[model samples]
Target: MNAQTDHASTVSGRQVARAALWLDLLHRQFPELIEELAPGRTGAPGRSAPPPDAAASARRSAADRADRDAALWNEQHGLRGAGGGSAPLRLHVSDALRDITDGVVELEEAIRDRLGLGRPPRADVPARLRRIAGLLASVADHPVLAEHVLAECRRMSRRCSAALGEAEQLVRVRGRCPWCDSVSLRAFPAWRAVLCVNPGCRCTEADCECRTSPGHRHTWAETSWSQLALDAGVDESELAVLVEAAEPADGSGSVSGSESVGGSGSAA
Candidate 1:
């Protein structure tokens, strides 16, 4: 990635900071993702690009996206009813998704730095980061934090899938090594690749489990995009868009603002 990612610092604090940034990033990327995956297929190729094939393509996309979410959800958590559903669910899901997205971004960037896959966070976002960080720090003691984290993660299972795909492509071109894109590694059986949600670890391979705990800062355990779809109720195609929308950039870079990442996915 880039050198600007190091600014997140090595600690739980980075999760919070990155969460905020990533939430903003998702909003910014959502439109692009929707356009890319569904993008309204050209229906008869007429004056106005026909009617745009929204029927068949949309269903296929939804299923594909859902499958991606199931993969992520399967590994780290089970499933929950948003613990509130709809109104409250959306609020919580939205908040948690934003945080988790940012935190994951931070963790990914941090891990990249460890494995030399990317650069460190920069100090430019300090002012805005502090605002979102304050919210996470304020609720540090709430029992719901973990639930919120998981819920947030669960909600993002789909987005995470898209991100993994993008990351996978990057890995493909650069290399699939969980570490930096420096080395090449293949997946096992039906799996394609893995992604790390932690920031300080060293993992050069797809199944790497290295984390900040040991000196191995770049390694990490990444579930496949297929896992997320397996767990969540979201359509596979829609879920795919979520994954794309949620993918973090090379560095800890994000749309803007940030909060702490979730300890678990919403399914937890």
Candidate 2:
């Protein structure tokens, strides 16, 4: 492949991988959420109590409160019908999963037809995603087909994420993005992802260590929060404080901010 096509393929692959990751996370968490909302379900099988860490405990408390609120909303809406306590939540999750699964299956069929490929065996959500990703990889040289597949993957990812309430809680980090210097950095607690919203973020600077491509927005997972803080010239503790403070008082998914911090060096 030419350089341009190669770059496009790489970017497309990354996006597809990201979409798959997010969907897989939702697939795992959805069941947990259902269990949480279920009456007398207690917790997942063999789920042990969390260790005695204050921060961990506090996070669990916040999550518990959010679950309680969700349950209350279900009750208010009269969702607790003959189907059982978790039926409404289960139905919602099932619909979301089905939507994504169907979308992926359709895309797979389209790609298979275009390539004159034989029908594949039935597969679950994760397997379907993997098959689609493989199909995209095989068609990387075909820009139109690759792009189409990538778009479908992203659409499914977005739908699943919305269903899972992944973006429901956003905490505005206190500093500008270290790469783009835009004050558009936001931490999504539900997804454990931080995003720099600037589309033209210059994250490819020599000293910058972000994994995202230049000109695209940068994303960091929870593991990179400390690195993000370091790049933004803020202490990790301060970052934690800002995130906590920015969380909505009523647990509504809203953007809030704390005091701004001084800018750090341009490079991470």
Candidate 3:
């Protein structure tokens, strides 16, 4: 049992590390995607800049920008408040980052699992895969290449599905509300916060510009591992272990040593 657990831990660690590498590459290579889709970075969705006016100029602060973006997004999506005005956007920009980051990781993992090769530790995995598939696609009417590329595209689609799976998993987790969870569509991990992808969730607590709904219920607890570690006065290594144990992994209450939302990805 001990040996099996150790092996699983090792495999899981490698998988997470490789996924992180891909995310880094994606961040580096296609930063525009990050800028457009990433939380906080994502601007007002599907809305053109308003005509210049004193009021528009007044809403130039980052917090105001985020609020306008969220409001515009909610309006475009036809997601009106249940009882009255706009539903207070509960999820924030960090939540958006978390969703996109987790989605990218899961997509990489899915591709690897489906291809049965995972991502080879050579160059940028997604880029490499895309290049190969593109080259194959360029070869017109070649049966073998066509078959191979088709297979690759099919697997890629599965990656999209896997990316979605993470959101579904996050939605029903013990502490958060289903509406918040459902609204959370993508995530991208940052140094300290998880970005929320849902347009409705586009601000951080510190910069929130949205009105709070009385019915809005946040189920997640407010426990801080770093604060706890500081209070405990543990060494770096000890703090690492304690922090790992406290995070929700694979939706299991117990730590499985596998990285998740609040895991090494966040540290990255």
| All candidates: TM-score | 0.27, 0.40, 0.22
128-224 per-residue lDDT for model 3 (tens digits): 4443433322332333333333333333332333332222122111111122333231111111112233334322344344225333322222233
* CA RMSD of each candidate after superposition: 19.1, 16.2, 17.1
Error of 3 at 25 (Å): 25
Ten contiguous residues minimizing lDDT sum, candidate 3? 168-177
Better of 1 and 3 by lDDT: 1
- How many pairs of residues collide in each model? 66, 0, 25
RMSD of 1: 19.1
Worst 10 residues of 2 by lDDT: 246-255
lDDT of 3 at 192: 16
lDDT of 1 by residue, 33-98 (tens): 433443335655455543438897899678656654554464347553433322322333344445
For model 3 the local lDDT of residue 254 reads 22
Error of 2 at 97 (Å): 2.8
Against the true structure, candidate 3 has what lDDT? 0.36
Sorted by TM-score (best first), the order is 2, 1, 3
Rate residue 72 of model 3 by lDDT: 69
Candidate 2, residue 251: the lDDT equals 26
Where does model 2 exceed 4 Å of error?
1-7, 16-20, 23-88, 168-268
Candidate 3, after superposition: displacement of residue 233 in Å? 5.3
